[model samples]
Target chain A: MNDKKWIIAGIVVFLAIFAFPFWYNMGKAAPAPEVKLTEKAKAAKQCVMPTEYMRAEHMQLLDVWRHNVVRNAEREFVNTEGKTFNMSLSNTCMDCHANKADFCDKCHDYASVDPYCWDCHLDRSKENE
Target chain B: MNKHYLYALLAVIVLFFVAYVGAEVFGLRIIFGVLIPYLAVIVFIAGFIYKVMGWARSAVPFRIPTTCGQQKSLPWIQPNKIDCPNSTGAVVIRMILEVCCFRSLFRNTKMSLEEGDKLTYRWEIWLWVFALAFHYSFLVVILRHFRLFTEPVPFFIQLLEKVDGFFRIEVLYDTIQTGLPGVFLSGLVLLAAVTFLLLRRILLPQMRYISLAADYFPLFLIFGIAFTGILMRYFTKIDVTAAKSLAMGLVTFHPTAPKGIGGIFYAHLFFVSILLAYFPFSKLMHFAGVFLSPTRNLTTNTREKRHENPWNYPVPVHTYDEYEDEFREKMVEAGLPVDKPFEKPPETLSDEKADSSA
Candidate 1:
């Protein structure tokens, strides 16, 4: 084969880059993060939306809440089951799921999603600490 | 409409539905997620090596690099280093520009015959622009996907994410703002570029005439993957946590298919797998073959170095000396010069005539 050394080197580089995830992980299983719900969250038995909907779309829902409260000046949210609640992430959602590290940060870190909610919204749980 | 593109489109659609139905209806997440992906990776690596090795084994016996400018010769005359490279360094620079910038394609021209035997050539730049866009965006999207596979996602991936989503375009429907995250521009650009490329192939008469099924298959397949990915991210939001878990598990060799990763995600994976498996067998192998292309990679240094034909070998030949030695008697009889006198002199034609008269 012509330029055999260079060809092999090129393939080696390609394999190293392409199989990066495999070597980077090194067979260490990254177990899916478990969101530890607080006592209040457990006792409430339900959230503003279904658990599945919240799991998939809590970010968008929070964004909508932010827009409504800050931009539209609407502080009230009427759920599908005809229950009305305050549209605040720090006050309302944090009332039940108060532990940001255990509840929010677990899945966010696992999924590598850096939501900017914490940039403005203070974690009261951390404030007490 | 070319039947080739239609067939290619049908194939991609069938593959998509097969994956969707397999995952959603039959609940065969293991097959779609684990088994098929593993198989596709294996096929991709093996097939890629095989194709590249085949190219490497072929002998290029001459310096046949396609040059558009002056080659190295006299000391006073300037040489086009990048265009007609004579040194290894110049060739490397040329290859870099060709690979990264699509420099050759940037020089693409469209030729047309005008009235009264007039021929005209115009620089066509759209293909180069869209091609560059498509390739770079695709690269960014692929790099961003590493976030799913790594446990502590690399710093570079996070930086890439930040750069890609710099615009932070929030999706809002009517007065009610949706909870969707910021849309990354790379995905959108990739989709748009692919659409343009596909449309060009379909809309242009010359391109459409030249394109085969192989040409359309990858485009349609990529379009499907991008479409499904966008759908998952924006519209039919899937449990990204579950998706990441599946991705991490696959990378760590602890394969698991967590529930709630929607059918569209499965469709996306299946399309990617098909592309990977098809890569080495199709024109997509250009990714590797570009390095091996004799016309592109070879340095134009025929004046400096000897390039011997690889197939050249010893050939048996009848030399002039051997021919003269064998026909020496005949040559001497016919009044031709001989290198050596014959031991037994041969009769001349005039002597034979005299003997016949006697």
Candidate 2:
């Protein structure tokens, strides 16, 4: 009988390389988080957009708000409720959420996504954590 | 297929670059990034499989191995085993060497004219070196691209990144950093090699005679890709997180072309898309064809074993029995021994049963 160790190694290596992408993605997805608004956000009367619409597309709203306020220097945000509020993420949005880790960061971390809001905008609430 | 037409083809590619970049700059990012890339990838996979299957289904009936050494006829003569493989195992070894190391190309030689028509031959190692470098580096670069397409890049890929980026230069006594990597070295080397290969095809009389538009097309396309990649990595720096997100989107089939991704990225992407689409239909399919090449895959054991053509058809033939029957009287007169004592009754017999079995 011939010792085919090299051949066995080669076959094993080939299969491993071929199965790389599959194995790499194994258990990669973070478990879904139970995202609940802050007590302050819950006590607030209403949000800038419809609650259903905000749940589905809050990022688009934030992007539009960022562009309007930062790039165009237009700070006006007319909510679907017909109330105009200043387009300030820190002043307007975070005022309701209050705690990023509990409200914003919970969903973001659960999604394993970096919204990069913390990169530029200082989170004053982090000092309390 | 003319050499001059290759120049025109290269110009056409450059024109495409300008058009694609222009379109991206003018905000057709979705078309350039999402739609075209998906279509190109689909065409690439489908066409690649079609070509490979077409070749795989082809009939290679004869043993036509390109032999360059002594045959394995006599027991004493040692054959050049790998180059002129006469067995299945040897053929496998030869194919592995050919595919993995490009062994045949490594043995490339160049002939030069000497004084008074005398000729001198030189080893053409640079071509092999450049070709090998180009391929290995391209592999490395592609592997590194895993980071973009993958969420959390694999450990092996991260290690590769670390090893690839090992070469670093700190200028001004460690005050300033260049961030130049060994990975960039190969990328730049690949560009240089392609350029050199193209120049050889253009400048060398012998190479120019054999060169065609198809030869220059892939090289110039690769040049465009490498140039654009270099530009992105070193010059017009991209938001890599955004790029990775875009890549993940593409892989997941959602394909959201992220905003603020530079026009240069779209241009680079379009070139890669075109390359993939063109690969299966062009000479680039040699990557697949090399394994199926009859010359390299066949063994030189023709004399040792009888090889039959798979497509040989049945044909009626005259046998020795029929010849003997026709010449029976003549053979007896000439004192030749006759089977069955020279059939006097000239009767027709079935040639199929007499000697047809062999």
Candidate 3:
């Protein structure tokens, strides 16, 4: 083949780039984050909705809760099971799952999602420090 | 609807449903999520190398660059260095422009008949615009996806994400509000640009006449991928944490199929896998082929340098001396001058003696 050196070099570059993720994590172990629930959360036995629904749709639900509380001036949230709770992230959600580091940041950091929730809401964990 | 495009669309739809049913209904997440992706990556790498090697093996015996401007000739004449490159440095700059900006396509023009029955050509720039948009946005989207594959995603990727999501567009509905209100413009631009390209093929008569299933299939397949991606992100939100876990698992070679990732995610993944497997065999190989194109890669230095054909071989020829030696008698009979006079050999003398004896 003509230009054998260039062709081989191009192929090498392509393979190296495409296989970047494999080499980047070759020796490092990255197990899925296991969120630690607080004693209060364990006692409640469940979140506002089912575990599966909360796991998937919690961000959307929180957004809706924020809109309701801040814009619409409505503070009460009724879950699918007809149970009512206050529509405040700081008061209601964090009251149970208080350790933001162990609960929220674990999965968020693993997933690389920097949610702007902390922009408005106070991180009580950091407030003490 | 063209049958070619219809077949391509049908194929993509079939693939989507197969993945959806395979994952959602038949409960084959492991196969869809793990096995197929790994197999697809292997096929992609192998096929790509095979195709490029095939191209590389072909001999380019001449400098056949498609020159637009004046070539290098007289010392006094001004030569277009970028267009008709005679040096390696000029060729490299031209190649960079061609690959990065689609320089040749930028000069595209369309011809139409005017009222006077004369053909007039006009600059057509939309194809160039959308093509650039499509490629850049696709690149950004792919780079941004590194977040899913890597833990504590690389700094450049994170920076790209922030810049891509800088325009925060708040979309609110009565019941549901858009979470992570940062609207990724690249995803939307990719969809729009691909839609434009597909529409150009369907709407233009010239393009439609030349377009094949190969052209339509990738467009439909990419549209399907982008559509499902947007659906998952904005509307039918999946468990991104679980999705990331699955992506990280695949990259780390510890493949895990996390639950509650939803069928749409699988469909997106299946489309991507199909694209990867189809790349080397399809027109998408142009991504690699463009770099190896002789017309673009080679410098126009035929005048200054020699390009010998590698296949050239020695040819047996009748020299002037051999020709004169064979036709010496004939030349003498025809009153033509000869370097050496004709002389009869012993074989002819014996033949004459036999004739006399007979």
lDDT of 2: 0.71
Candidate 1 positional error at B346, Å: 5.5
Q: After the best TM-score superposition of candidate 3, give how far the Cα of residue A49 lies from its true spot, in angstroms.
A: 2.3
Which residue pairs of candidate 1 clash? A60-B179, A60-B180, A61-B179
Writing each residue's lDDT as its tens digit, candidate 1 over B1-358 gives 6898999999999999999999999999999999999999999999999998887777777889999799999999999988999988999999999899999899999988889689999999999999999999999999999999998998999999989988877766665553367788999999999999999999999999999999999999999988998889887899998999999999999999999997899999999999999999999999998888788888999998887886789999999889988998789889998777765645566687888999
DockQ of each: 0.73, 0.04, 0.61
Q: Mind giving the per-residue lDDT tens digits that candidate 2 earns over B1-358?
A: 4646468466647746664666565788778778887888778767876776566556667878888677788888888998888878998999999998998789899998889698998889988888888888888888877766665555677677666666643222223323222234667777888888878888888988887778888888888889888776654555554566666666655567776567778888888888888888999988767877788888898999888877679989999889888888899989999775865452334554455665
Off by over 4 Å in 3: B179-181, B318-358
RMSD of 3: 3.7
In terms of lDDT, the poorest run of 10 residues in model 3 chain A is: A24-33
Could you give the candidate ranking by lDDT, starting with the highest? Answer: 1, 3, 2
Report clashes for each candidate as comma-separated counts. Answer: 3, 0, 0
Candidate 2, residue B273: Cα displacement in angstroms equals 0.5
Per-candidate Cα RMSD to the true structure, in Å, reads 2.8, 11.9, 3.7
Q: Provide chain B's TM-score, model 1.
A: 0.91
lDDT of model 3 at position A18: 95
Q: What's model 3's lDDT at B88?
A: 86
Q: Ten consecutive residues with minimal summed lDDT in candidate 2 chain B?
A: B170-179
